[model samples]
Target: MKNSQLYIITLVVLTFLGCKELEPRRPKEHSTTNFYKEVIEQNKKLNALETKRIKQTLDRDTLTTYQSSANGFWYTYINKDTVSSQTPIKGDIVTVKYNVTGLQGNQFYDYQTRDYTVDKEDFVPGLTEGIKLMKKGETITFVIPSYRAYGVTGDGSRIGINQTLRSTLTLIEIKKPNNETK
Candidate 1:
């Protein structure tokens, strides 16, 4: 009877130990609000520095004048054909010859010889909005802030954290979707 009692106690202790190991550990902090606030503050500081850098670059350039939109991106036409024509709206398939570079003049991606569709959500918000302000066969250069470009996380390769981007886009074609598809 004493041997059986010892065996039962050992079994119970082993079972409790196994259950404790199986349980998930809880984090010290339940809320990530402070972490998110820190990220936002960092982004804001980086964005301010980038904006100043872009403005300085523009000021030193004697070749072209830059302009800003309500969406907070700077743009200037390299070559413009028509300004009175219709701009590309939503559901418009646009082909653009483009080049993208960082604020420090490091080239990231370029497709000068090819064409890409202009989906509303596919491209960065700044590029999309910049394209909408251009007519067909027009070339425009623009500066996209970090928030509007890749944001804090970036594109994961050439673009780094909180990096602003500069792009030159030439709108080659614009094909609006039909009413049935819309």
Candidate 2:
């Protein structure tokens, strides 16, 4: 009887241990919500710092008056075509000669001439809007923020990540769409 009782107790203990509740395995890492929130906060801080730096640069420049664009960039005309009222429309092909420089005026790209179909081609985001603001024979120097210029990933060549750019653009010609006669 003693042996049977001891065996029964051991069996009961083993059964209980073996029937332990199974739980779903959880990841050791943090939740995605927390990670996204951290990314947003970091981006906010970066944007603020970049904006402050841009403002400081603008403050020091007394030679040119920069006009703030509604699209979140600043521009000053190098050569304004006051006589011509026409600007590039959505489908108009525009020929431009432009050069890119850093905020401190270090050249990233030399003067290159390219023809772009306005609002229809892949070009610099800020400059796309900047082009529409120009008439033929107008030259404008645009100060673009990093987010509007290249965002986190840059042009993958000379421009680095989160680098703001100053581009001097000359609108060489604005060719109207074939549907519209000159």
Candidate 3:
């Protein structure tokens, strides 16, 4: 699977989790009882299905399974070149300029505030993880899955479910949101 394709799959999970669907017996918090267990099982099957779909649809002969960390809400990768480590942590305010696109190459979120929230539960899982992996003046690309994004219900017109998302993220700057000093 290509990174781009992997990104889409992750977005699906992200969006699915982000969706606040109200179930009759569902609690206020995100519902795990409704379909998460089944959903996870389905996701495993779907992942395989997606891998096949991508390889067949794109006619990719040299496709490799693109992998993302399954443990955390967020993950990061240093550019193949950069060496230093100044990893981002929770509560770190950051400024980023990004362009989110889909498989057909549709534009989504354009650059706005670099100091956006790094909240895991707010945005999709892939995005929440992809952004915090940068330093001042750094750019990275992400291929997020729908599950990790807006899921099937999606967030109005801004995002769609089961649709893979592509992003070229540039970390403009990193600063504390409320704190004035170190």
Candidate 4:
């Protein structure tokens, strides 16, 4: 009985000693400054590439009359209808038809006619600015850089990362803030 107990104790001790205690895995530590620097550098590179691609597209399409906007998008009105000369403000609701495309001419979305409130935060900066330049019945075409559209992290699907977007907007109607609820 003593021999068996001794053997058991020895076995237990051997087993306990042989077994390794599991350590919790810790993620690698990175400096925030370094991470921020890397992000800034990557943004610079992406901007450079996007600019080059835009230049190439403009050259290929032979687009020379596009006026550069203060916010970096290139735009030109294709047609202007002699309706109301009044453009939209932030509180005004605007009815528009738009076709959004990529630099390679891939269409993203097309709306024959839709209504949107002129909220800058709700849409891309390029589209918001583009709409502000239009009056009722005016149609404008805009070539938006990636920074103004989806930016570095795209729209999570058809639009890839750092992709430039081209969009054409036709303002169908403009409703005043008091008349917009209907």
Give all candidates' CA lDDT scores: 0.81, 0.92, 0.63, 0.82
For residues 52-129, what per-residue lDDT tens digits would candidate 3 score against the true structure? 554453344234333354522222333432665564567776667777777557887775555565673376567788
lDDT, candidate 4, at 24: 98
* Off by more than 4 A, model 2: 1-10, 23-31, 179-182
Model 2 scores a C-alpha lDDT of 0.92
Q: Where's the lowest-lDDT run of ten residues in candidate 2?
A: 173-182
Order of the predicted models by lDDT, top scorer first: 2, 4, 1, 3
Per-residue lDDT value at 94 in model 2: 85
Candidate 1: regions farther than 4 A off: 1-39, 113-119, 179-182
- Model 4 alpha-carbon drift over 4 Å, by segment: 1-30, 81-85, 180-182
lDDT by residue (tens digit), candidate 2, 1-182: 99999999999999999999988998798789998999999998998899899989998999989999999789999999889889999999889999999999999999999999999999989999999999989999999999899988999999999999999999998888784522
Error of 4 at 57 (Å): 1.3
Best by TM-score: 2
lDDT of 2 at 76: 96
lDDT of 1 by residue, 1-182 (tens): 99999999999999998877566778787568988999889868877888888899888988879998899899998888764577787778777889889876799986664543555457777998898888888999889988888887999888887778889889878776552311
Looking at model 2, residue 37 earns an lDDT score of 97
Range of the 10 consecutive residues with the lowest summed lDDT in candidate 4: 56-65
